[model samples]
Target chain A: MDSAGVLLDAQGLGRFVPGTQQWLLRDVSLAVRGGDRLAIVGPTGSGKTLLLRSLALLDPIDEGRVLWLSQTISARLVPAFRSQATYLHQRPALIEGTVEDNLRLPFTFRIHAHQDFDRRRVASMLEMVGRGADFLARSWHDLSGGEAQIVALVRALQLNPTVLLLDEPTASLDASTTQTIERLISHWHERTNGKRALIWVTHDRQQSTRVAQRVVQMNAGKLLEGT
Target chain B: MTVDGYIELKAWQVAIAASLVLLNAAISLGLQLGLGRSLVVASMRMVVQLLLIGYVLRWVFQSDSVLTVLALAVIMTIIAGVAAVRRTERRYPGVYWASSVSVLVSSWLVTSFGIAAVLQKADTWYEPQYAIPILGMILGNTLNGISLGLNRLEDELVVHRNLVEMSLTLGATSWEAARGPVRQAVRTGMIPMINSMMVTGIVSLPGMMTGQLLSGVSPLQAVKYQIVIMFLIASGTALGTVGVVLLSFRRLFNRNHQFQSGLLTAAGHK
Candidate 1:
């Protein structure tokens, strides 16, 4: 792939047990371009989560660099980088307050200070997933697992991030809710009109094929392409 | 050596007061509380420690040298710093240094201000009578605040690891991600001092005021000294709690706005 279309590029990323020689992720390199859909499938304990976290700069890596827009990201620009490239955890984490509060949290950060929370925008997104405007007023604690994941998805999508690193975002949800999440993510990618990328890690091979255009397999801390 | 109209207790009289621990031990044994041995041991340790400190203070006072007073103050501050982090259930690397620096800076600054600016009657800035007690009181209270703050911070970070990381992943600055835990920790640390302040002069008599009253100082004079001590302690505890909490925040998060949860290990974990 040429560098022109690549939005996120990882070169030989590795993570190891601190103060030990045990490697958790080794020599993994991947390129994500705008409008690209990639799925990473792996068994439990195969370091897929670690790989995704490393790409997002959520976890420290023992080796290699991640470049954004063809330039290595600097420490000062990490927040800016994160704002454009967001990570979604398998389990949703919402702050104490209403669902709207959790959705509005990102705007409270200095990095997003220039942005304002758009309730109408969020309400419309909720409507896409069969949720009403009242869903936005629901308390965070009242949200079911699937509902929380929807909130997490809407929150990230509303930010208009260029890249989304999803770590099995619908792992525990039911079939229909999982489909809804997948559809929501697909819509998010398509809405950007080939301007956004997705790196999804999932256990379901069918879901991988359904949501992603390219499939990669991770086994024993190594990335195998064209699985 | 006793001042006129001020009664001095004899050695036997103090021994009689010391015997009160035996009564406590007897009650513990009768109740099968399993605290009899600990009660006796603690009382014995307190007696020895207090007696040794009494002799040390007397010697330093007689020497009347600035170095002696300052050296004792530094030693006390170091001990207080160590004691502050000793009981925490969780700790990160450099926690000792963080706690110690917080304790040393807050207590020393407040004590110096008290001696040099507030209580200006001392012949020298390092007057043992004024400086030692002031430092001790401030250090004691500030130690509690630092430890409480540190413990609460660790607990919040650990329990809410996902929440904190979620915020960071959403592009929060280190301060923004940690603002909630920091606020809670600082409040936890300051609560005791605030409670004491709320109850002062109403619910219970404070130690320094009681000491002054027993030493034949006028009630109004004792009250004034107690007020100064209370204010100094309040500032010291606030500063120390905030300092330690902020320092731990820096240690727990990096310049990249990542929450380094790995750095924080629970107590007794390798």
Candidate 2:
């Protein structure tokens, strides 16, 4: 990826177990450029989720810094930065509401106060995943695992975020649903016209190879390039 | 001696009241409940503590000094604040300070208002007869509210860590992300007061009103005092619960909208 196209960059980022010398993520540096598809694969305790969280600036970093478009992020810009770089959890958490309420949640936030929730935009996005607009009215408890993940994806994608940090989003889903998610993500990336990027953390090597153009490995709180 | 139509209890009469605790211990022994020792120890502690407080209150009332009354009130508040955080299952490093400040500010504010405004018949705002009892009642109720609020806040945050973080990653400010837990905590804190208010008169006579009646106060005057005390307790509890919850929110989350779940350790865990 070209340096000028870099959207999210981490420089020697490190996170330790609060007061102990034990490192949870150490000396991890990564550069995510526009339209880049990167996957981080590691063992269960290898800190892949921590690395992704660090990149998203969701966790406190004991050392190093994360930059947005080559500029170091300040506290004031964190909300805006998060709006543009959304993090997706492995187990989707929907509020106690219908899917439409979940989709409208982001607009309720102060950071997104100026934005309006466009029903037509969300409906068309749902259509891409082969779901009808009627699906939005489904209660959160009624959604199947695959369907909940779809709502989560549509919720994040509707915000038009520049970078998506996904942490094993399909780790528990079946193969068919996983492919659908992969297709939906690729379609979203394609629609961004090379101005969007995604960092997918997964355990399945075949899935990584299928979705990511470049794959990195994590082990013992350290990042290794090229898998 | 009988004074003002109120019967005074003799030392032997008070001992008769103390002896009832032995019956509780006897029942514990009979049932093999393993609470005999605890029951005896708890009753003894209560007797000793109340006696000591009785003496201290007597001395303060005799002294008639504003400093002594205010000092005692402060001591009661600090103890109440510490006791409030003691029952929480999850706590952070600053939980005690947060609880204490919440209890102190809310109880004092409401008590001061009661003394300076509602009970203006008192010779002084810091009159020991008026201030100490009012502050103590407010502190007791405010302590309960702060404890419940702080406990519920930590519980919700810990249990719903994922949901809270999900909101944060969606670009929510800390206040926005924590709205659910905050609301729940405040509600939980206020519930006890609300329930008591609902049943205050019809269900049972409250302790203060009952005490006033036994002390030979007229029924109507006692009812008025009870009403004021109830309102004071309610406001104190509400203010304290909200103050502690808001303070905890500031401690648990930072300006960057990050939920520092790591800061919360299970109570008694290293």
Candidate 3:
């Protein structure tokens, strides 16, 4: 991948809850290249989610700078910044709309609002993720957690984001669905011509080795050296 | 025969007043109890606050001092600020101060413009009978709105953390990530007011209009006043909900673009 793929440069990031002053993430520094597959593993309450949010730019850091294509960016530009990278939530949440609505959500934003959304393209994306084209017309309530997660992933993929942040993307899925999504994600990573990066957070060590090139372990808000 | 000096009370007059009190009580009760303890306490607090305000209004109306009326408005806003702060479960230390300043500033600006300059036919710009009641209504409605917007926004901030992150990573600003949820929060917060508005007159007569009729204002005059009050409520709610939500957004997130966990602690039951 060329310089166009160098998605993020995050340094000296720190986050403290406004009142309790608990350091959810403190002085964490990370640089992500395009196509880098980094899995973040941590104990519960260790700010793994917080770190994902910071990288995704959903939450703001108390100290540090996040640079996108060398522009000084902060919370104000989170949506625009993150659209370049998709973040799959720990718990999949679909909007109170139709299946097609969730799939079309990113395109509705001003950042991606102008992106072309065609039935043919959306159908292919669904099929690639092991879903049928007819699934697009289904009601939001009908989807199981695993189906919702896949749909969320597909929605994020629609933007062709340079980075994908997965927060336990398969935690709720059955073994078969997990394997299916894992395989599909790996295939999509290659098809992007190595133009994209994936940053996944999970507690499952086996899933980490299966899906990630490098595993970064976190505990008590600090990163530990790998085994 | 010579006419008697005493005014005669009509049967319909007593019925209207009784219904007004009952309806107000029921609506207030529904909001307080159905929504949870915060709303209930809020209703009680509103009663005590308005009653004290009634006494203050008497004093202000009897006097002609502009400063006293202005001071009274300021005091009302301060109370509103306290309510906004206390309403949130995970309130920051400076929340009260922020809410107070925002409410007071917005209310003063809106009320002064709406009444003094636009509705300039009043005897005095600071007339307590007119200005105080209007100000109280505006401040009271805005307080509820800001509280709802803040509480709902905090909830979204937690629940939609990843959606926000996804947006942020994609080159969205923090405000952009939070924008959808913020807009949702404000819209949801406005629902109760909007629902009441939709059902007004059809479901039940509103309180202020009923009060005016019982006090001997002509039905036409009371209806006109009710129309004006409804517009003001909508206007104040929009201004207050938007202003508070926007201002608080800066504090709600960190420099790193994470929603502050402390906000969750401050938010009371949904």
Best by TM-score: 1
Q: Please, what's the RMSD in Å of model 3? A: 6.5
lDDT of 2 by residue, A122-218 (tens): 9988887789989999999999998999999999998999999999999999989998899989998888689999999999999899999999999
TM-score of chain B of 1: 0.96
Q: Write the per-residue lDDT of candidate 3 for residues A1-227, one digit (tens) a residue.
A: 24454668777888887546888788887777867888888788888888887776665467787778767764456656667766778677677788898776666567776777777877887787678978998888999888887877777776777777788989878999898788768877887676777888999999988898999998888776554
What lDDT tens digits, residue by residue, belong to model 3 across residues B121-228? 455778777788788888888888888887787777777766665555444556666888789878965777898899999999998998887677788988988988
Q: List where candidate 2 sits over 4 angstroms from the true fold.
A: A1-3, B22-34, B121-123
Worst 10 residues of 1 chain A by lDDT: A119-128
Residue A151's lDDT in candidate 1: 93
Specify the CAPRI tier of model 3: acceptable
- CA displacement after TM-score superposition, residue B118 of candidate 2 (Å): 1.4
- The true-versus-predicted C-alpha distance at residue A7 of model 3, in Å, is 4.8
- Local accuracy by lDDT, each model: 0.92, 0.91, 0.75
Question: Between the candidate structures 2 and 3, which one is better when assessed by lDDT?
Answer: 2
Q: Kindly provide the TM-score of model 3 when superposed on the true structure, using C-alpha atoms.
A: 0.76
lDDT of 1 by residue, B1-270 (tens): 477646787889889998888888888889899997788789889989999999999999998998999899889999999899987998789999999999999999998889878988545877678888889999999999999999999999999999888988888877888999999999999999999999999999999999999898999999999999999999999999999999999988888778889998878886
In terms of lDDT, the poorest run of 10 residues in model 3 chain B is: B1-10
lDDT for predicted candidate 1 compared with the true structure: 0.92
DockQ, candidate 1, vs. native dimer: 0.83
